[model samples]
Target: MGRPILGLRSTLKSLTRRDIKSYMSRRYSAESVFITATGNVNHTKLVRALSDSIGKIKRSGKAQVIKAPVATRSVKLVKRDLEQVHLCMGVPVPSMTDRKRFELYLINTMLGSGMSSKLFQEVREKRGLAYSVYSYLNLCKDAGSLVVYAGTSKESFGEVLTVVLNEFEKLATELTIEQLNHTKDQLKGGIVLALETTDARMMKIAKDEIYFGKSMPIKSLIKEIDRVKLEDVRKSIENYLSPDNITLAAIGGGMKKRDLPSVLK
Candidate 1:
């Protein structure tokens, strides 16, 4: 459900205790549970503590299942009187377990994840078309997306879009081995740096458990990343970043629906 808005009452009034109990009974089953902890901790004590509390929750025979939402290849434009135009373009990718997962991560880092990335240098530093530009991969259990976002003045929106699209198109054909290695090193450094923190390690452990059913050792993950080749990156780009698969979303004033096709093309 969407967040309830203040001063605007929802169609449904306050929920009764029975409604909440029924919903929890269906959703919070043992099959849907996971517990993760980091730092100085006793597993047995933690389990016991949890058992004393959440263990009382009755398990439903099975947890509720929901279908994954389909990815759409459409453009949506939201007009508003704003100083800058915001644009997001995305294309679907495989799930986290796919062999191309690491390659996709490398692709994002090379494309825009940091100050040294292509989008950052070209779109912001050189052209000054946008103040913020980045690309990221969102991976889920059954689906994923590679999304690029940029915010620019309304006058520069079209130019920024063209530059973003050109960058994506280049990935399919012009990615270089040197660039690939550089990005891989960058990603490896990032992984090592992230693991150095307790909170980051905790999140990594939780995500690995939720997605892969086990925690992967940092060395093992690094090995997989190191094994990624230039060919692998190009193949992933060709398979996933095709213009035909793209979806665009824009918000700002002075945007015409007709402009989307040309920009995306």
Candidate 2:
């Protein structure tokens, strides 16, 4: 919430209780100062659109109110005392525009993407090393990171963690050209779909400007990702992925720090 969505219309900003005093004095009250715009708007459409829908649902003269929890990064957490843990890891990434940034991303997707990925195929589908395993990329202002996550039973957690580390090290040294290219194609496919509509274009422009201060053409960005070489990806894995730099947010009854340090190695 440090920076709000830019697509929101300024009028939709509600009056505080203090500002309500001024609102009552003015002809254009808070209710009247509502609008809709195209760029960056999503839930922000509440002012122009949703208020009516919400009003219709409240058919009676009485009112009911419900409040949702605040923003949270954790999507799901349960306490079953299951003999396993789920771990989320993130690393530092390069700039958004850098073609090489996608190198790590491609590797991650291929290594963890569903039935076709190395992690899912080896860990979950084949050997039952884990119930869930995957990899992803997160990009921010000047840096981003490749991340991998897994849910493993406590008995298998340490062993599966070692297997994950082996997979990472293998990418740096013995990964095949075919596997690397497949991941690159996966990255390309993902980037292409991102600009599927005018709304997407506008959102990209707004977010890019907010993050990088300059808007990169979608085509140009795609070309950069397409140009990446295997060597670039290898360097990213070796240089960026490390035991000391890795941060794992883990949840489970069986989680133990003693068994985790070597995976980032």
Top of the candidates by TM-score: 1
Query: Cα lDDT for residue 212, model 2?
Result: 59
lDDT of 1 at 20: 79
Give TM per candidate: 0.90, 0.63
The true-versus-predicted C-alpha distance at residue 153 of model 1, in Å, is: 1.4
Minimal lDDT window, size 10, model 1 = 1-10
Give the residue spans of candidate 2 off by over 4 A: 1-84, 97-99, 261-265
How displaced is residue 245 in candidate 1, in Å?
0.7
User: Please, what are the lDDT tens digits per residue for candidate 1 over residues 45-153?
Assistant: 9999999998877778877666667876788889999988999989999889887899999999988898988899999999999999999988888888999999998
lDDT of each: 0.85, 0.65
Question: Which pairs clash inside model 2?
Answer: 7-39, 83-154, 93-144
Q: For model 1, what is the error of residue 88's alpha carbon versus the real structure, in angstroms, after optimal superposition?
A: 0.7
